[model samples]
Target: MPIIGMCIDLVAPSLPAIGQSFSVAASVAKSVISLYLLGFAFGNFLSGFLIDSYGRQKIIRLSLLGFIVASLMPIYLHSITWLLFARILQGLTIGAVSVTLRSICADVLPPERLTKLGPWFGTMWGIGPVIGPVIGGYLQVYFGWQAGFYFFAIITLIAFIVVFIVVPETHFNRHPLRIVSIKNNITEILKNHVFIGITALMGLSYALMILFNVSGPFLIQTTLHYSPIFFGHIALYLGVVFVLATFLGRYLLKAHTVEKIWLIAINVSLLVGIIAVIVSYFFKDSVILTTLITALMFISCGVVFPISLGKGLSLFRHIAGTATAVMYLVNISISSIVAYFAGFVDMTSLVPLAWMYLFLVFVIAILYWTVLRKS
Candidate 1:
């Protein structure tokens, strides 16, 4: 799961450098992130059935190997086209691993236990965003953009070895590869309004993060003339806030129903979004104020993501792999589209980004009240 974050955040600080290296606009460089996410969505769609048919271990090992290989492609090729290609490959492989890992958790853990452990899981996953930019920032300043890809290769290699040696197969109830059965299962899951609503909420929450990842560097580094390392530290700070908020969410869940927690979180996010727009409008270049407000919004996401994901996955445990895949596929696909269009938005001020945040939260509210609450 951290691999997914690493794939995105590790290269984030280098986006400008990547653009300079290839003599392109920042928006063109951002295509790397958007295309990676498209590949992730495709991979999830494909891996779900393979995971259900062949089980977890085999797919995990193969995907890790592919990820290692793909991680090395951009280091040697030096072309943005090749970099995008490699990133797609990386996304594809890592996407598979993500679905497989989630399925393994669903296979071994009961729903209550999984929900209880959600904060810990989110913390571990949060590590990538926490460290990726901090490391990437220095690498960009000292070692150049290619260094991030080299780091990716090294870390994925370590992960590959660990999984091969330590992780055991968890999915035992292997379904046969039948087209009709796969279609039916997908149709059934999609037909569940609760699943659809929860996944939409998840997608919208995640898109907020993706929008920032897509636009933050240019806003902070390019617009405000901050150093990549400085931006990295900002990312680190936000990541910490996200991790801490997940624990806060865990504590709240113990005392409240999931519905109540979600409602509180969503409304809080809306309020934060309102604050962000006002602050950005008045103090357009105040990075501190922007980061502070963004952190508040992240607290909402941290609270919502684990609860939504656990609840959504629990609904179709008998087909955990497929459900996980469908859930991530929809969410990441939404995120990818957002990432792509985000590049076109002006970064001269934080107003556009703040507005985007507010609008997304508003939509999340609409989805919840109209769809999720009833379902």
Candidate 2:
């Protein structure tokens, strides 16, 4: 999980440096993130068919090998074009590992144990995002942008070794490889309105995090003239809040219910959105205000993340592979689209970021109050 998180997130604080190194606009450099997400989405979408056919462990091994090779491409090839291609390839392979592992857990665990896995999965997942940028930022400051990728390569290589030795194949019931079967499975899952709503809500919640990851570098380092290391620290601080919120969300869910937790998240997001609007309108472009507002917003999003994933995954035990793939595809795809467009927004101002969150949260509120209420 950390490897995958590092693959995607470690480059965040270094976006400005990467742009300067490559001599491109922020929007074009942001493509590194956007393209990776699109690749991840496609990979997850495609893995649904392959994992069901080949079994989980084989696919995971192949994917990790691909990931390691891809991570090295940027260093060896030494060009932005090769770097972008490598990122896309990394995303593709990452999708296989992530989606397959989740499916493996779902396959082996009982309902009671599976219910317990959400927070653990979240914590493991959160650790990467929390530490990856801090490490990457320091790496970029002391070393160079390519140093982060080297770190990625080494860490991922170690992870691949660990998985090779310890992890076992979990998919016992292998479905035959057929295009029609894959399409049918996906279509069947899509018909579940509850699943659709939960997935959409999860996607929107995640987009909030991606919004910052994609835009923070330009906003903080480029516009505010902060150092890359400082930007990394900012990410670390918020990441701590996010991880805490995940654990807190799990505890809260044990005491309350999904609807209640989601309701609270919605209200908090709405409140944060209002404050952001007010700040952006008046303060205009205060880095301190923008960072504070975004940090607070992440708390609400953290609460929403695990609960939605647990609920959505709980709904389709029989088709965990397809379900997990679809869920990630929705999330990464939405995040990629949002992050890509965010580059076009006025990075000199905080208003666009605030407005984007407000609009997304409003949509989530409607979904919850209406279709998602019964579910």
Candidate 3:
């Protein structure tokens, strides 16, 4: 899960430097993120089937090894094309690792236990976003862009060793490799209105974060003339707000239903989004204002993400791996599309980001009213 955060946020601070190194435009460089997410989406599909067929341990171990190898590619390759390929490979492996781990949690932990621990899990994953940029920023400043990849390889290697030594095979009821069964499982999962709705909400929540990550570097660095290190500190602040909000969400869950918590958080998010738009229009260069508004939005996302993920996964315990994969597939695919298109948006001002945030929140509200709320 943290790997997912590291995959994006760790590389984000170096986007400008990467573009300069490749002699490409910022828009072209942003494809590194979009393409990696596309590969992640596809990886989910693959892992869903493979994990169900072969079991979690085998797939995750292989995926971790693949990620380590992929992390090394960008170090030796200088071309943007090769870098994109490496990112795609990294996404595929990390996506598989994420799905496998989620499936393992669903397999081993009862729903009540899973719900109880959701915030802690969220905190762990949230740590990546909190620290990735801080480390990447310094790496970009001192060791160059390649240093980030080197760091990735070293850390993942350690993780692979840990997993190989400690994690056991948890999936006892393995399905055979049958395409028809796979299709049926997917169809059944998709047909559950509540599951689908929660998953859609999860996708939207994740997309909001992705939108910021994809656009923030350029807005802060090029438009506001801030250094990557400063941008990293801002990201660290937002990440802390998100982590704290997750704990607040956990406390709220003791008294409120998941749907109620989601409603409250999202409505607050819509209000924050509106404020962001208004503020951006009036004070375009105010980095502090923009960061504050963005932090509020992150709070909304932090509250929604873990609860929704746990609720969605709980609905399909029998097909936990596939369900996890589908959830992330929808989640990352939305983000990938948003990230790709965000490159074309005017990054010279914060208004575009503000508008995008509001638009996404509106869509989320509508989805809740028509889909989740009714269901």
Candidate 4:
């Protein structure tokens, strides 16, 4: 999850240089990031199914190869379209890696362990976006954008090797693979609500950050007139907030239910909306204050993701792959589209982000209170 999130950051710092290299506008060059995410959404669903039918080990090994290969594309090619293609490919691989890993975590650990794992999991994935621009900035300034891709590819290669040697198929099926059986099982997996809700919530939780991906750089660099490095630091702070909040949630779980964690996180969403209004209008667009508030919004992500993910996957042990697919499909699909178009929304004022935040918060809140709480 962390690796997937961080992958795009490798390209962020290089956006300007990449734009110049491709002779495109900064906005146009952003397609590298946008298309990658779209590819990510596309792959999330595919991998969910693949994990179930093919077995995690095979999917894991193959996806890692894809990730490493895609990460290396920029090392040889200078064309913007090719770079975009690499990103798309990497996105698909990342989606598979993320969904599989989360499914593995769900299988291997109990709720206590899940809570313990939450901060670490959130921290790893959160580090991607936060750290990407930071590294990309320095590399773009010192070495070059190409260097970032090279390094990223190399690191993921190591990760792939480690997983290949150490990871095994957690899903112990007595039977061998068969085409008719695979389709029938997948049909059954898609029918479960627990998996559906978990995945839906996954997308919702992630949407907060994805919107940040689309608007964050522009908001900090263009609207607020801060440097990319400054924005990167802000990203770091938000990542830190998420990390710490996840830790806090880990402790909370010792005494509370997953539902309780969701409730608190939902409350945080409301606070973020309220803060967005104040930051947008009152502060007159101060980056420091805005960043701080945004981090709080992101903190809610820590709470819901780890808890809901664990709870949702627990009920679908019989069909882990199909359950996971549902989770990623809903989560990635909704967030990517939302984040992509959200770019067009006016973030010059916090009003747009504020309204969207409030709308989502209330929607989830009402759903939980009237529907889920009863369940």
Write model 2 residue lDDT over 1-375, tens digit each, in one string: 867666656889778888889898888888888888888887887786788788898889899889889988988897889988998998898988888888888998876667657767777788888998899889989998999888877887898899999999888888888878888888889999998888888878888888888888888888788898998888888888888988988899778878888888897788778778877998766878887888887887788877888878888888788888898899888888887888787677778778887887787788888888876
Query: lDDT value for candidate 2?
Result: 0.84
How far residue 203's Cα lies from its native spot in candidate 2, in Å, is 1.0
TM-score of 3: 0.98
| lDDT of model 1, residue 253 | 79
How close is every model to the real structure, measured as TM-score?
0.98, 0.96, 0.98, 0.88
After superposing candidate 3, which stretches have Cα over 4 Å from the reference?
Answer: none
Provide the lDDT at 328 for model 2: 88
lDDT of 4 at 130: 65
Point out the worst 10-residue segment of candidate 4 by lDDT.
Answer: 171-180
* lDDT (10s digit) by residue, model 1, range 1-375: 676677888788989889999999888998888999988887887899999999899999999899889988988887888998998998899999888888889899998887676666677777888898899999999999989888988888899899999989888889999999899999999999999889889888878878778899999999999999999999989888888887888888789988999888898888888888887889889898879877877787788887788878888989989998899899888889889999888789889989999998999999989998886
Q: List CA RMSD, all candidates.
A: 1.1, 1.4, 1.1, 2.8
Q: Assess candidate 4 and give its TM-score to the true structure.
A: 0.88
Q: What TM-score does candidate 2 reach?
A: 0.96
Q: Compute the lDDT of residue 269 as modeled in candidate 2.
A: 85
Q: Which residue segments of model 1 deviate by more than 4 Å?
A: none
Better of 1 and 4 by lDDT: 1
